[model samples]
Target chain A: MLSQENRLSFFLSFASLLGVLLIWQFSTLPQASRSPYGIPDGNAEYQRLMGRSAVASTVRSDFPTPGAFARNAIEVLHAPFHNNGPNDRGIGWQLGASLLRVMIGYGLATLVAVPLGFVFGLQPVIQKALNPFVQILRPISPLAWMPIALYTIRDAELCAIFVIFICSLWPILLNTAFGVASIRREWLNVIRTLEVRWPQRLFFVLLPAAAPTILTGMRIGLGVAWLAIVAAEMLVGSSGIGYFVWNQWNNLSLSNVILAVLLIGLAGMALDAALAFVQRSVRYAE
Target chain B: MTLFPFSRRPYAFRAAPCDHGPALACQCGSTYPGIFTTGHENGLPTGAMSAQASVPAISRRHFLGAATGSAALAGLAGLFAPHAAMADTAPSGVVEKPDLNIGFVPISCSAPLIMATAKGFFQSEGLNVQLRKTAGWALIRDKLLDGSLDASHLLSPMPLALSLGLGGNAAQPIRVATMQNINGQAITLALKHWHKRDPRDWKGMTFAIPFQFSMHNLLLRNYLALHGLDPDKDVSLRVTAPPDMVANLKAGNIDGFLGPEPFNQRAVYEEAGFLHVLSADLWDGHPCCAFGTTASFAEKYPNTYRALQRAMIRAAYFMQEPSNRLEAAHIMAQAAYLNQPEIVIEQSLTGHYADGLGVVRDNPRRSGFSPYPYPSMAVWILSQFSRWGYLKENIPLQETAQRIFMIDEVRKQAAALALPAPEDGQNNWPVLTVMGQRFDAFHPPSYSKG
Candidate 1:
């Protein structure tokens, strides 16, 4: 049922992935045996003392190969809901904790930004008055606020949520304002001549016109929120995917850290796709 | 014909009597006298009493009385069970606040606190404890001051630094209830420096310590100064977290580090570094970490504080036994605790480990668990503070040591548990040897001339 070009593209993607894995595996293979040049007098004891033995040195390599990563990934995913203790939980629980935080933070950002953005769009003077502050704050990185937030909030979980809230606020606010302000003036004039009340005019005419832009803004905000949560969780570690990464790093298990990175990427892509689907639903024909 | 066949024989009369004599017959004796006197006073038939008494045993009157007395007393005890269950009181005092939140970093140094939670020492003392594994020491300090943590595993000198308002936001009086571990740190250098053993040959090399206010820092400085290299001008010191120390070493970002185990062991495990020297070799029996809390928390919950102290002391005692170390390492290596390999923690705890030179050495004093809070140790730490210019003005050393160390409280708690106390005069200022030089606590050497 697929077109020729579509089939070719699929083949190419698969081939590229195979190629990368092949390269990774080959690079990590043990090299040919070489003379122990650094050892003095060709002494076996000296070579062993310096940790230059072939078997001992390769027992735990600096980087894990693709094969090792695959094995570790399967093991981690096999029991994704196990709870060992407060510091250690399965990947499923870690993802669930992170998603919960993102939802609460993103939902709060929407509730505040949509309304205030409407006000900014409707009133040019008000937007101008607040423009300097918004521009100043938006460029600041989210992690920069961590120390101040920790000191003032006095709670680690709340501080992480506060960081997500800060990062997600700006994009949604700006996009909503732009969408509402750019609405066709002819439609507004027609509504006014039809003697429509302000409430009906705002809800029926303005909301529908700005729906797509707002959705786009939400997609961007969600992306930023997801990005900030990992770093925040790493700083204030107890339980989360970020904490799982940190805990493994402390244990010097690089393969597990790589596994977490993959999971985070997959979760981020899923969130963007979900937002994109919602955006399509709100699209209108020109 | 009887519905209950065994009921024909009186169960109380068939029960065994106490072996100890009547005067020392335990709780069972209390009811024995009452039962015997009651029967005699009631004038039970002498014919039956004499027949039973002739069976070559104690009088039937006394035997029956002791059995029935014990059963009645047991029933009474059951009647008052709810009150006993509600309080769960320890022998010392009723715990005012049984639920607690104690914080610790994931290192072998926190073995006492972690073992206490795992071994049920806290529960035995009627305290419900939740151990929070924190990210770093700074967060531990912040959480403790903010009241989120009831107590925490702190650096030995941290309480003194916090009280003096040197490294913290405000001056808060903190109390060191017990010393957690002694001499459990080491200086590990990158493998490139395998041949650079002499400190005099090394200049411009950066070293990482866990914190500026840590004993690692002071000791590293002292070691450097003894080698005739100025720590300030010759070498760069960075304050890095323990978890990052090994990673940084691997990346060639640092030349070496004087950090707590098992990171030093971890570096050797990873083949990124080799153990250059153990902290124990530099200064034997130096204090590394302490079990600490704010003075206000201790005052507000005195009984709970005592209960915490007792639990930690017992845990320390448990760790001192060489037989219990492997078990301690196994429990601590789980995901909820240190989250490390069992062998790595075992190496650090048992003091038998590969030194990364293909050599396995054993020195049992590599890591010690002692609950004594010696005031002289505090004075020594303060003198280091003065020597390093951390103190803007010289404070009264002995007064500060006595105020913060809580030696008297520790002595009293240790005695109550029937543990042997340290010798008399051990708490006073005394001369100690470090790196083959005598350090007189009475007259600390002046570093101002340098």
Candidate 2:
């Protein structure tokens, strides 16, 4: 959709990353200049390549060399396609489990949060009555819910979903309530004067009017749901990204752990980006 | 075809000593399957075998008639039940109650848990035993307290530590029903660190231990203090859970760690380190893991407690046999906690463990469990806890020791089969030297004396 020159600028941005990598590569070369780190200075690809090789002098005297790093990188890139490689879990499986939990929990939270938020949104007295309890629970870290969830629910998977539920419900509820309450009184008055039924008024007028704010709340809620799954998995002790990271860490496989972390970050970015795209395309009412 | 299918049968009361239940039955219905039934002669009580030896010579005709009737019934019962019947004629004071979810760390010390399940000891006593593999000793402690687990394979000092309220605010008081296993855990120090300095120069070094307040930590501190190193001020001690210690060492995040077995082997394979020290050398050989239950569990389920103890003794006897290591290793490997290659399992079983100090040359024996319950092990651990500031100044040591070690329960279980009262006795074998000093464990003392 953009001009070629503009696209070229976007592609060229990667050059900076390449440049930093090159500098890193050169600095880590087996022999560059004699720095106090004690790794031999040589141009061989198999030589000291991480620049800081002081610790490598022990067990793995020559690991993380340029060749080793390259091997590790290639191994990481192909990790998704293989079974039980150093970074064995493919992106698809990792992202699917996380996305599945977020969607189900977020959907359930929405079903409850939206209607209650609307009732409170319209009635000032009701909102005031419920505000304190919601406020008390809102700031509690989602991790705090893990023990209660595990002890209460017999199943680990369900407990994880429950944690996601606790984390995401509040934002959507508060936002939807705020969005419904803030709707211009004139819009409701117009619907009333036209003799529209209450359900019809809600369906056709108020919802569309408050859609942007509601979506904003959903966006925030979805993010929280994604965040909560990691913590939930850690507590539940089953198959999930959080457990995967923990298992790898227990095995002392730092590379796999780092790789999982990277995958989590990328998946989170993709999710946020997708939500942003949806928000933009659905922005027609405003 | 379904790999696992189900069949229904009428109510079956297990009526013989050999009836182990369907779960342990071979899928093919073959009587003795691979790694399933070892048929070790440990199920019978130790002294009962000797007492039965004194049975006067009876008439051949009378003996033949008694044996014939029982064998015919055993054959018919074997066809339907396909296992031994529960021993309904259990001696009095044998635990009257027994249904348990027994938590265990998947180590060789847990042989009793496996043997009890295999030998029909629990079933014979009307006990339903569920073995749960836990993350570490700390979780075992927590689960026992919260009733998630009825009992657990616990570190020796756990009962004492719990009673003293050493762990954070939520500490629950506990007592040891029996000493489960001993001397199985070894101290593993990283090879690189070992090469750099002797263990006596332990000052300013960081070591990994399973828990901050565990018995191993206390032992390590005392071992260091004897050599003029203050564990608190001179060394940087990091708490690494057992499962992570091997990897932590391989990755060089930690210099050395003290843990049970196989982890030491993994470190050796990685060429990342060696075990330069061991717990055996520290305290002449000390109490390690024990079976612990909440004081309430002991009170409410005294019958169950006796049954658990009886079963554990059966398991311990199986481990005492030298030939059972191969089978024990296989079982440990299958358990989710120690799921890995058979070699790691084998290495841990043989007690051919090497650590920062040197290779422990002792052949595998039942290192952890006590034949006779020892109260002194408690006093030894308590002194260390006090020394390390985990406990305040010593509070009535002997009374506390009495409360923690459930000798009466062990004695009741032991006497059922007419076995001798389990006394606090040591295998007065050879003495071990650390840093050219020989020490006798007859009276476990602080490191200065050892």
Candidate 3:
């Protein structure tokens, strides 16, 4: 069912990825040969049981090879939804918790941003006046909000939500502002002559025409939201993909971080794909 | 779940001549009714009685009298056993809250808390404890204050600082149920500092401490002050994480750091730095970390709190056993706990370590376990707080120490009231030897003032 051009592009993309993996494996060969911490003391029990050299093994840098990745992927995917108390849980549950937070945070951001964006776009005076505060806050990293949030909110879970809201707010707000502000003057004049009420004109004319730009902003916000959520969760040791990555870092297991990284990438792609679908439905060819 | 979920009644306490029979009796430390497991009446020897000083000397005769009352109690317990068994925390009045979360940082100082979880000490005490590994001291403080964590392993100085409202928001006073570990911290210097080993020569050098309100900072400042160098003027002290200390040292961002083990040993293990001196050398048995909770939490759930105390104190005893050190360290090194390489952890735990100066050191008391939360130690810590300008106001040192650290009799022997003891548990007041100068709890302010 695939088109010729599409199949050719897919083949080329696969070839490029294969080329990268091959290069990565070769570069990490020297790392795998020696222990990352310069010690061969991994399986201390092997010395006690069998008196073998393998007993005092070292952990390699664990730059994941294609084979290692496949093995780890299988192990991680084998039981994706096992819940073990608070500290430890299945990857499925962790992913779910993170996604749920993002959705809530992003949804909350949208509720605030879209309405405010309309106001900013509708009113030039308010937009110019409030521009400085948004400009300053937009460049600030989400993690910078950690201490302040932890202090004021006084809960790790809420702090995470607050962080996500802060990080994802900017893009949606700006895009919606642009979308609402740049609505065709003719469209408004038509609504005006027809004596259409403010609410109807805003909803029917403004929203539909600006839907594409708003969706584009939301897509960018989604990417930034996922990125910020992980970092925030890492700082706060609450349940999230970020917590998983931080916990792995505590164990000095870069391999586990890679696993989390791959999962985050997949989850991110799925989210983007979902938003893109919505974007397309609202999008017009005009 | 059994008809009676044998929890409120700990394994150390029995209901009726022990279900296994008196022949298989254990020296159950205290006398709770229906738990006739002690082989002899005076089973606790003098050495044991010293520890059991906190445990009331409930006579076997009075205990048996209490036991008869327990049979009646058991009949009542059987009536509600099924309902109780379904609940995580006993709906029964004994343990107000059962399922609890205890937090700890990933460090050797958290060995007891970690062991208590791994060894099922928490469960045996009839408590379902979730041992959450927190990220940092400040996070632990926030979590504890916010009541998200029922209890946490805290840096010894943290509760003191928090109670005094020094570093941040206070009014939510924290209490030390018991000291978790002692003397497990050390000063680690970069290999570059190998030549200028003496403290006097280290002028203008930057050093890191785990936290501003940590014993690591206190001890580092004390050491510098003792050597005639002002900690503020002569050297710089930056707050850094334990794991990050080694990386910072390796990066040459810091010349040295005083932090908890096995990070000190980890630095040596990774060849990033050399162990300059163990904290044990400066103060032979200084309190490091404590198992702590909010004062309100301890007051609210007395039984649950008692069970926690029993587990943590027993685990403290278990940690001090020389034979248990290596095995315990290995357990701690697992990904779930300390998460360091086992061998590196073994070096600090077993007291046989490569000091990173091409010499091996063996000192069994490198990390002593001081389970007792002596008020005197807190007095000394208060003096240091004043010396360092953390304590802005002149609060009564003894009063605050007793209020936070001394653990007054109101809640001390929650389960062992059948036995009798003094109100405050600091009878043989600790005579601490800090840097060849004595710190007698009576006047630690003067000792620190110099």
Candidate 4:
């Protein structure tokens, strides 16, 4: 289905990726030196312990080669959902845990933000009164909420969910308020002239008009929720993909960590894509 | 389920084993041994297990040979063998709670909690014990305080510090059920300072300890002070977790750290540091971690508490036999447990370790397990606490030990199980010795002249 230029671009991208892989493979070969200039630099004693030859001690270069990484990827990704007790689980299980937490927290945030936002949209005085607090809380890093959250909540799992809720809540609330407030004054006049019931006027006119903006806010919120879940899960440290990455780092297992990083990226992308589809569905033409 | 603590932070140093540009590498060619789930948990022992269950039959053969040669050993073998006395003494008709949760940091000192869970010692007394690894001693204390954990492997000094209101919780009154292990901690210095013999030469150096309320801090302070360096003024002490101790040492952020085992051994294996001195030698027979719980938990479930104490003591006894060390190491080195390299754990447990200076050192007390919570040991801890600024108020060492240690209950439980009871030091406490001077037994806790 691709055009000739599009096909050419795809081949060029594939070729560039191949080039990068080769460079990485050769530079990290067993003979590669740790020093930047491709030579081992250390005290005479260290050189003697690890011979004067430029070849690295297999233990010294913690990074596995590209072949090794691919091998690990295939082995691990092939059967991803193995549950290994509470602390150690497979990649699929961890990803599922993370996705579940993000959705629960994000869902709760939407429930509250939408209703409260409607109130603020209808009343200018209420929005003005809340603006200072909202602005201050919005810019604060979500992870900073961890210590206070843990202290007050006492449950680490709840603290993680609470943090995600706090972080995602602001965006949806602000955007929903903005969307509702900016609906054309003429639309409200039309509904009034037609004697449209309060519920009908709100649902049919206001919601349809605001759907695109609300979806945009949700898309933004989803991205932040995915990002914030990783950070929050890292601190709580019970289970989740974030804990898998942390535990691997503790073991000094870099390949497993790389696998986790890739999974987190893929998960974030998929979540954003889902929201993007919703945004597309709600788009309105002028 | 143990806590992994932090997943994404600067704690993750790009495994720059070489200048490989963060290119992911295999975690060695061997597949990581399976992490077990509940299905794997039933019937079959999965992953790295203490080959000890099979060991009892083999151990009996050796015990028979030894027993045939000696009369005293025959009696000892009968005592050492796993007994049904634990099941016989279940009090209160039924346990108020059979399913219990205990948290422990992943260290060799946590042998009691770990071995009990690993060997089905907890299951023997009808207790379904769930053991989880906590991030640190402070977190363990918090978990127990908040009732998230039923019991935890705690530092000997921690409950006392909490009871004394030194670390707050004025009348929270957590109890020490039994000691987890004894005489098993060491001071390790980064490779750069391995040659610096004198503590006097180490002024202005920063050292890491597991916690402020830990014996590592107290002992490090005592060791430095003995060499004429005021710990508070001369050298800075940072509270670092056991797992991060080696990494921080490699980064040279710490000059040295007096921390728990396997971590100290781990440093040497990684060639980041060398053993400076064993805490066992510094203060022989000091209590490290204890199987502890809130006094309220004990009051509410006496039978359950007794069952847990019996299980832990038996597990501690199992860990004491030299033959069990290798098996214990294997059990702890699993992904579901300590999740460490088995050889590193084996080295610490067996006391045959590479000291990071190319020579192998052997010392049987590198890490030891003893279940008895001696009152004198508690007194000694309180004395050290007073010596440092940790304890501000004047304390009656004897009365304090009696209150903090569950000595009367532990003695009854040990005796009922026919396990040897540590002599109660009720009337006369042991002489507080070492640190370049000896203080009489009856002196107040603030008597340390240093």
Candidate 5:
């Protein structure tokens, strides 16, 4: 059912993934024999305790192999909703908490950005006045704002949400403004001649014309939001995927950290894809 | 649907007492009413009270109702029963604030606080505690000052530093309720330096400490100075988070670190570093961490403060027993507390551990749990503050120590728990020997004279 081009691309993607996994598996394969470096002489107990003895092969490389990663991943994914207590929840719960925080922060950013972006697009003078401030604030890293946010907000949960809101705000605002300002003059003239009222002209005319561009901006905002939430959650350590990564790091379980990194990537990709689908749906023939 | 077939059971079912083991199952069915009946009684041991109070139970009617998609509702009722029962029985006006938020860093130093929560010491005392696991010491300090935390696990010198307004902190009066732990830190070095055991040979190496105000910094500086190497000029010391210390060592960013265990033991477990020296070797029976609260918090909630102090003291007494240490380690290693491997925590707590240099050392004094807040310990910490140039102004050291450390209050609480209190005179203010140098508590040497 697939075309030759599609089949070729799929095959290439699969082959590349296989190649990477194969390389990972080979590189992390334990050495057949390890040199007993610094193993004190005549202390068989010491050598055994240090995993240098021939009988006990407890010493492992710091990096997890593909097989180890797969085993850890299966263990983690097996019970994704088990809630042990406040500090230890399942991976599914962590991801859900992070996603919920992102959605709330992203929603608030959208609520603020779109209306202000409309005003900026409608008035060139207003846009020129605010442009410097927006440009200055946009380049500030989300982490830079964390301490200040924590200090001012005085609540860890709100501070994390505030960080996400700050990071995601600029992209959507700029994109919506740009999209609104770039709407064709001919359509505006047509609507003007028809004597459309302000509300209809704004919603029916302006909204549809700028829908794709606004969504493009929202797509970028969502991407930035997802990125910011992980860093935020890492700083505010109660519950989330970022906290899971940090807690596992505290335990020195590198495989669990790697698993979290993969989950974060997959979740981010899914978010972007969902927004892209919306963007496609709102596109016009013109 | 196949991904999570267990999802059909309410999420609370996972936390059901039955899921824990057979030991908890017997308590689940029989002991619910006994807790409520005994809730009004005073002077009962906290361990017994909590053992009875901790079992969340489903009533017979609720259990039958839970089968009809009401499991979560029933679970909520079961969870609220203990608090409701405690509130109803709490002699009306005694505990002003029954609900409390206590913050702690996820380290072995916070073992007593973690154990108190895990073993339901707070619940037995008619207090509902939410123990917030904070990220770092700075966040802990900030949260404490901002009133977000009722009390917290602090470094032994943190309350003093905050009280004196040292290290960019506002001069706020924070009181040390009880000393958390003693002699639980170590200087761990990367494996590359295993051969270079002597400190004099190491000139250009960088070391990491948990905080500038921490005892780790003072002891490390003292150790380096004893070796005739200036800590400031000969070596670079970086401030890093405790959790990141092992990763930083493994990445070769730091040559060594004088940090709190289980990080020191964790580094050895990961095979990234070897223990160069335990802090116990530097200063035997040194105070490391404290349990404290703001003076205002204690003033407003006096009864609650007393209850909290008693619970912590009892927990510390429980931890003092060598036989109880392994079980305590297992309890603290759960994901809600330290979130570490049981063996790593066991090695740190039980003091029987491999020293990463092909030696299995058994030293019971590795980490001690003493709840006493000695005034002399604060005096010694202030002396170090002066020694390290952290105290620019010459404040009254003995007066400040007396004011900050609630020695009498801790002694009273320990007495109430029927634990042995330190005797008068030499026992309370004994001379401390540090790295073969005598430090008299009565007459402190002037570090300002160099």
Candidate 6:
């Protein structure tokens, strides 16, 4: 299916990747030394065997070892059923828990934000009145919400969920309001002339016209939700990927910590990709 | 089951060594000769277990004679004998369950776990126990619900919290089958915060705690209130995870923290903070940790539950041994979950006690040592829950307290082990003082009301 130029470019990229890997492998081999242009780095292999190395290497065996880190990453990508020991708190379980929390929190936020956004968008006076309060809370870092959420709410899991909701809600609400308010004057006039019912206008004309903006808002909100979940999990200290990473670090198990981090990044990518796909599906109508 | 608490002995039941042909081997790669039989026992089942059961049959004289050739025979025997006998003399109705998975936190407070496993106390009870170190209390609760762990070393208020349906958890009837430990927790004040106030003045300073719902926080609030300081109006109280407390204090982020063991010791060693008050200071000799299980688990496995308690009691006795402290610390260091420096663990595991107010006292002080399961402690926790707003008014305190602690079951287990029984049936035990004036008894009702 590919053109000649495209096929050649793909091969070139593959060859470049192979070349880079070989250079990296050889540079890290036992006898390799730093060039005179830069200072000669000490023997990492010696330090690894001596166990009297820096705390970072001693704490995490996989540290400063690209190959080991890569292997760990590959292993984590197929976790849960793939793990073969009593201590394997898998990457997949953590990813699932994080996603579930994000969805529940983001869903709740949308339930409240969409309706409130319409009200604020339709009535300028109401929006103006609420703007100050919204501005005050919206820009506040979501992690700051944890203390009040826990003490007042007295539940860590709920607190984490609430924080995710707080962080993700603002962008969606603001964008939805902007989308609703910016609907063309001609469209409203057409509805008014035709005597279109308010509900009908909202369901048909307004939504379809504002769909692009709302989709964009959702994309932004989902990204924020993903960010908030990781930070919240780290703070909340229950069973989550964030806790798993922190727990590994405390035990000085660096390979697992690095593995968890890769999982978090991959999970974030998948979440954003899904949101992007949905946004694209809605774009043509707008 | 018996009522009395057992002596602090590695093995509760003692019997004369059985006279067998040769000493039996163990599956743990050690030759424990003259302990149990190597082959079929009195027409019992065949296999290494029979070998294990009969190894104890060897006489004292034979045990000495076999030590020379024991290692070679033990390797061959280890191939056959699958288990080591737990008790010197097995009691009737004692071997209830053969296998169990118990939960413990990977803190210095979990000395009983390392001690029990190392000394083979659980093996004596004919049980194969797995000690799982859970992440935190909440996860432990969930694991209990899902049957991941049969029992757990839990915070004192956890059972009461579950029963009251607090924190939006469905009401799961919880029972305290036994008390695992008592009186090793301290409230550490960050050095910067301590410098900001007079040593005598504990008013108007923010303190960090592990959780808002924890007993340490409640006790802190009560202690402040008892001194005429309003906890809400006087100072802000923040929550920090126990491990993070030391770093946060060193960075001058928090004023003080309340936690159990080594973390407190670590803070002092780092010069990040100093002990402000022992939790026991507020309520003299309070219970901090207990073996908690859902009532469903208790109901389903009554005999298994008793056996678990017997194993825990034997483990507790092993931990108190003066000679075993170093080994216990080493075990903790090597454990996958704990894996901290032995010095840090030893500092916390050392049984020496000191009041935050600079008063020193001996652990297991003859004046007040209540390690046995008691109903009064449950009642005390209930009163505290009501004292705070966690439980609504008009709950039947006595009935709920009785339900939470299976005093009769614990007594039965204790009596079977030949341990000391509760002298007074849940009487008003007096509060003893290490930091201040001493007393023999306390009025639980008035103490809460005040």
Per-prediction DockQ comes to 0.23, 0.10, 0.20, 0.14, 0.29, 0.08
- Put down candidate 4 lDDT per residue, B1-450, tens digits, no spaces: 011112111211111112111221221122111111001111111111111112111111211212122223224434453234334443324777999888878788887788898888788767998787666676677678878899999988998988877865555788899888766788898887755757888899999999988888888887788678889889999998776788899888999999998788778766678777776555545678888898899889988898888788777767766678889989988876787788888877866666565545566555667676656667778887878877877767767776778555664454444443232222224454444245443554354544
Q: What is the Cα-based lDDT of residue B317 in candidate 6?
A: 43
Per-model TM-score versus the true fold: 0.84, 0.65, 0.79, 0.82, 0.85, 0.55
Model 6: per-residue lDDT, tens digit, B1-450?
Answer: 122233222222211222111211122222223211222212211121122111111111111223334333334433442233323223434555567777776666666655566567667666787776666676677667667677787776788788778777888888887766555576787754543333336565667776655666776676566556666677677876666777777677777877866677666544466666544333434566777788888778766666677666655544533445667778777534465656555545553433222223333211112235555566666666777667776676656766776555554454344333333322323233322323322234444443
Residue A89's lDDT in candidate 5:
91
Model 3, residue B252: displacement in angstroms?
A: 3.1
User: For model 1, what is the alpha-carbon lDDT of residue B139?
Assistant: 85
Best by DockQ: 5
lDDT by residue for model 1 (A1-286), tens: 9999999999999999999999988887765433222312224543443345646333445788888888989998999999866766899999999999999988999999998888888888999999899899887787897888889998888888998899999999999999988889898889989999989998899999999999999999999999999998888857788888888887878899999999999999999999999999999986
Per-residue error (Å), model 3, residue B64: 30
Could you tell me how far off, in angstroms, the CA of residue B104 lies in candidate 6 after the best superposition?
3.7
Interface RMSD for each of the candidates: 4.5, 10.9, 6.6, 6.5, 2.7, 14.0
In order, the TM-score of chain B in each prediction is: 0.79, 0.70, 0.77, 0.78, 0.78, 0.70
Number of the top-ranking candidate, with lDDT as the measure: 5
What total of clashing residue pairs does each candidate reach? 0, 34, 12, 9, 0, 32
What CAPRI class is candidate 5?
Answer: acceptable
lDDT of 3 at B383: 89
Candidate 6 has an interface RMSD (Å) of: 14.0
Specify the poorest-scoring 10-residue window by lDDT in model 1 chain A. A33-42
Report the C-alpha displacement of residue B397, candidate 4, in angstroms. Answer: 3.1
lDDT of 5 by residue, B129-221 (tens): 889888888889888998889999999999999999998766999999888887789889887887777788779999999999898998888
**lDDT comparison, 1 vs 6, better candidate:** 1
In candidate 5 chain B, what residue range of length 10 has the lowest lDDT sum? B54-63
After superposing all C-alphas onto the true structure, candidate 2 shows an RMSD in angstroms of 12.7
